[model samples]
Target: MRRGFKTEAKTLALELRAEIGLDAYSPFDPYAFAAEYGIAVVQLSDLDGPARHHFLKADGSALSGALIPNGTGVVILENDAQPLTRRRTTMCHELAHVVLEHEFGVSLSDERKCGLSGDQEAEADWLSGEVLIPSDGAFRLARANATDEQAADAYDVSLAIARWRMNHSGARKVMQRARAKWA
Candidate 1:
């Protein structure tokens, strides 16, 4: 997690708030915000559809969303009946991709390439996390959890995303030790 990304994410969140007439740092709703921004929204009935794989691609590889060039529209998979928290986080992640303008005329295949070494993706993920789980709130949740799953459920996000946030928040060693002891 870079300082710059955090700064930029907060900045963007504020800008979005003003643009949408939301109070500073109000709860973010991707669907509403996307609509307000003049970006077309496409809903997929396939989010809950059984696929032969682990991810559900909305535009590119996996269940990720990409903003079309010039911010024309945002394509997202509709995760019907999924936990609200999970849906919110995923939407936020897609929004991050859009806000960062990652879809600037690039082919979908070229954009779907995910290798762990990519800082851009990491930055986007970080931005998504920041926007969804503000730092103070995240820290408070992390402190009360007995397990990663508990934390994930509390935050309405995936365990991997929760774990990553924990690691970045300096709670990794404690959380890991707790898990090891309990496991």
Candidate 2:
């Protein structure tokens, strides 16, 4: 991700969290967040075959999710066959696109048919990570020497995501510094 874009995403994540009344350590509810912003969340299963196929890779691995522009609002389509954790991440990602007001196109050749530029995808991915596992929450867990499992449990995220966030969000560094101070 570009440094400037990541900074913007982080700022947006914090602002969204505050707008939704989320505390530093609380698990973010992407559905509620979408609802607050007047976006609709729909399951891929609810769509017809053609529409479903549009969001799936030929290998059958889900595309995770997609954001479709509606009449003034947007609809988020999530692959429900995946695990809940995956669905949560996908929803957050799609919602990130909406929150950032990324453009969409009418043609399939468009990136995921959503006109998301490469930079937009990176920003959304980073922002979604922040939304699912806020830095403050990661730090709180790290301060307690929490394991990846603990971070997953605390944030209701997948273990892999927890590990990434704990390692990459500067939480581990903060924890080490706190430990040094105590020592």
Candidate 3:
């Protein structure tokens, strides 16, 4: 990411949430967000083939999701066989790539390798986290002293993702520092 990328992502996430009639405090729906952007979302089960089987497997090695750029739009294919929470994260991840306007390079190779540069991928991952649980939402959760599982349930995200957002977003640390200062 660049100097201003994180700030930009935070603003975009909150704005997009508002555009969908959701406040920064509400859970985000990637499917609705994708429809708003006119991006298509398809499930891997909707496909039929050996590749689908490979990608749909519940194993840890299975593909999470993929983004394909169309002429002026994009489509997201997610591994629906996974848990719903995992699917949601994957959808947002693919949407993040589109939202970031990342120039594609194959996206998926013959060996199922992602073509995005590491930086681009990292940027997308961070941006997707913002989209799923905006900084404002995370901050509110932290202020309430919400647990990771509570945040996950509230945001409809996985426990790991919720914990990552809560920990890395600095919301908890900020609140802790504020409490200590006032105490």
Candidate 4:
């Protein structure tokens, strides 16, 4: 990711949240956001045969979601068989790619073009995380002494994702530092 990319992503995520009549602390709805952007979100259950089995019921499926671009607009294919939290994260990730307008070649059937590799993929991942749980929201949860499960429930995200954001997002560390300073 670029140096200022995270900062930009945070701003954009907040703005997007506000656009959907939500605050930074509120849970993000990727489906609604996709609708707002005029992007079609289709579930993998909509597919039949091999495609459905590959993404939904396959063992160790590397694919979580995909963004398919067409001549007029793009559509997001979400693996609905995954858990609710996972489905949300995947939707946000696919939407992030569309929002970033990253260029890509034709997508392969396998895991070859699973969101286009390298920087674009990284950017989409980071932006998706931010959209799912803003850093500011993480900090607030930390300050409130919220546990990973609490954060997950509050944000409608997975506990793993909540823990990752609380730890990796520097929210807990910042809260600890603040407590030390006040103490």
Specify the highest-lDDT model's number.
3
- Candidate 1, 45-126: lDDT as tens digits: 4434464133454554343333334435555543433545656665676666677766432212222222233666676677
For 57-133, candidate 4 gives per-residue lDDT tens digits of 34555356777776778877776766888888877777777888876332323321343778887787788888888
Local distance difference test, each candidate: 0.56, 0.76, 0.79, 0.79
lDDT of 2 by residue, 32-121 (tens): 888888888888899899977877777776666666778887787777887788778777777777777766421222112234657777
Model 1 misplacement above 4 A: 1-3, 10-28, 46-63, 70-87, 105-119, 171-183
lDDT of 2 at 89: 77
Q: Which pairs, if any, clash in model 1? A: 56-63
Decide which is better by lDDT, 1 or 4: 4
Q: Candidate 3: where is the Cα deviation over 4 Å?
A: 50-61, 105-115
For candidate 1, the lDDT comes to: 0.56
Q: Please state the error at residue 159 of candidate 4 in Å.
A: 1.0
TM-score of each: 0.57, 0.84, 0.87, 0.88
Q: Write the per-residue lDDT of candidate 3 for residues 1-183, one digit (tens) a residue.
A: 677888888998888788789987778898898899898888877887875766543654556677766777777877777788878887777777787788642233211125576777778778888888899999999999999999999999889999999998889999999999999
Q: What does candidate 4 score on TM?
A: 0.88
Least accurate stretch of 10 residues (summed lDDT) in model 1? 105-114
